[model samples]
Target chain A: EDKVVQSPLSLVVHEGDTVTLNCSYEVTNFRSLLWYKQEKKAPTFLFMLTSSGIEKKSGRLSSILDKKELFSILNITATQTGDSAIYLCAVELFDNNAGNMLTFGGGTRLMVKP
Target chain B: DAGVTQSPTHLIKTRGQHVTLRCSPISGHKSVSWYQQVLGQGPQFIFQYYEKEERGRGNFPDRFSARQFPNYSSELNVNALLLGDSALYLCASSFGAAGVYNSPLHFGNGTRLTVT
Candidate 1:
């Protein structure tokens, strides 16, 4: 079975604190890893990482995948209260017979206090 | 442009009742996918349809079924609903088929179903 696990299931930090969320996966025919931020309704896309070493960044949020270690990490710098949300990590796998599918982790709940 | 849209934002049904959820993918998107999300958990894939054809499916039971129309709109039907079936059904749309890589899925607010 394909499995994705996220660490520090919940976190509470004051504004301006830097936080790191972790996601580890075990799957066959790995393709890519993606991050999403869920506020209330729909989850918004954050980043997609397919390679190791190199990092993908968007403003204060950045993510990097380490395929060798079978894990990824998402970082938020100088976080604000608005940054409070659940961060989800998903691994995309491609099987010759099953095509492509995304397996998701339980997600990390972040709460930034003002 | 409008994002993916799902109908019947909320619903309540009995354990033996049946329900259908509708979805309209964004314009120009040929692929539509369904997912079920329970509270505090990540969404689980249910089915994927592209060009009105079944492309991929998850590990869900046969009781959960879905179909896409020629217009790329889709409907998910659940028969003999169970109390465990209470969840948020999400509809996502992408520009390409399931085999296409790097295509992000645009999701709708989802339909919340509660089974008694």
Candidate 2:
């Protein structure tokens, strides 16, 4: 079965600090890795990494994938209380018939305190 | 454009009852996927539909089924709902099935189902 594992199930940090969330996976025909931020309801998209070693960045959040290691990391710099949310990592893989489906990790809950 | 939209923000059901949840993808998007998220967990894939055809299904039981309409809207139906089935049903949309490599999924607020 395809599995995605995330480390440090929970974390607490002060505002302006940086945090790194990790995700590793084992799947067939991996295509891409995606990151999302979920607060109380739906999750919003963050970054999608299709290439290794290359980083995708937004304002304060960034992510990179390591295809060889089957892992990805999301980094948030200058974090604020608004950045507090459950960070999710998911891997998209092709099925036997070449169709795609996403397998998600357990997710890491982050708390940014002021 | 409105991102993805789901119906009935919250619902309460009893065990053995059936429930139907609806979703409308963003305008111009043709692919729709369903997922279930229990509290304190990541979303689990349920099904994916493209152009109103079933493209993929996940490890969910037969009790969980979904269909896409000609308009690209979708509905998720769960029969004999159990307490364990209570979760937030999420619907995501993408532009297409094949070229989804770099596309980020747009999600709905989700329908929160509580099975009593």
Candidate 3:
């Protein structure tokens, strides 16, 4: 069965502190992995990593995929209160569903205190 | 683009009742997928449709069903709703179906359903 797992279910850190979140997955025909920031109702896209291109960055946030180890990590540098939210990792497989079918991890709840 | 849109931001229903949640994908997007998210948990895939055809389905029960229209709009219907069925339903859209591995899914705000 395909599954995605995240480490450190929850974390609390003071603002400006750096944090690292982890995700690992086991799936067939793994095509890509995606990261999302869900502050409230909907999740906003953060990055999509593939075997050929395993790293992505945006501002203070960055992510890397290790397909050989079947894991990925998201790093937040100089975190702010606005960065407090659930960080989700999902893996997509080659399927008849446009790769839209994703297996998501439980997610890591990040709390940044000011 | 307006992004994905879902109806009834919030809803209240009782066990054994039925509920229908609606969604409209972004213009030109041909794929739509539904997900159920319980509080404190990541969203779970329920169904996926493209060009009015059922493309994929998750590990949900038969009581949970959905259909996509020619216009790329979709509706998720849950029958005999149980207390456990209460959750937020999320709608996501993509530009294509099958083999479009790089297409990212754009999501709607989601519909929160509370079953009493």
| lDDT tens readout by residue for model 3, B21-99 | 9999989999999999999889999998988988888888899999998898999999999999999999999887522
Instruction: Give the Cα error of residue B109 in candidate 1, in Å.
Output: 0.8
Clashing residue pairs, backbone N/CA/C < 3 A, model 3: A98-B98
lDDT of 3 at A88: 95
Off by over 4 Å in 3: A95-100
Fnat values, candidates in order? 0.48, 0.55, 0.47
What is the C-alpha local distance difference test score of each model? 0.90, 0.90, 0.89
The TM-score, computed over Cα atoms with residue i paired to residue i, of candidate 1 is: 0.96
- What is model 2's DockQ versus the real complex? 0.60
Residue by residue across A1-114, what tens digits does model 2's lDDT show? 889999889999999999999999999888888898999888899988888999998998889999999999999999999999999999888886426888889999999999
Higher-scoring candidate on TM-score, 2 or 3: 2
Ranking, TM-score, top scorer first? 2, 1, 3
What are the RMSD figures for all models against the true structure?
Answer: 1.3, 1.3, 1.9
Provide per-model DockQ scores: 0.60, 0.60, 0.52
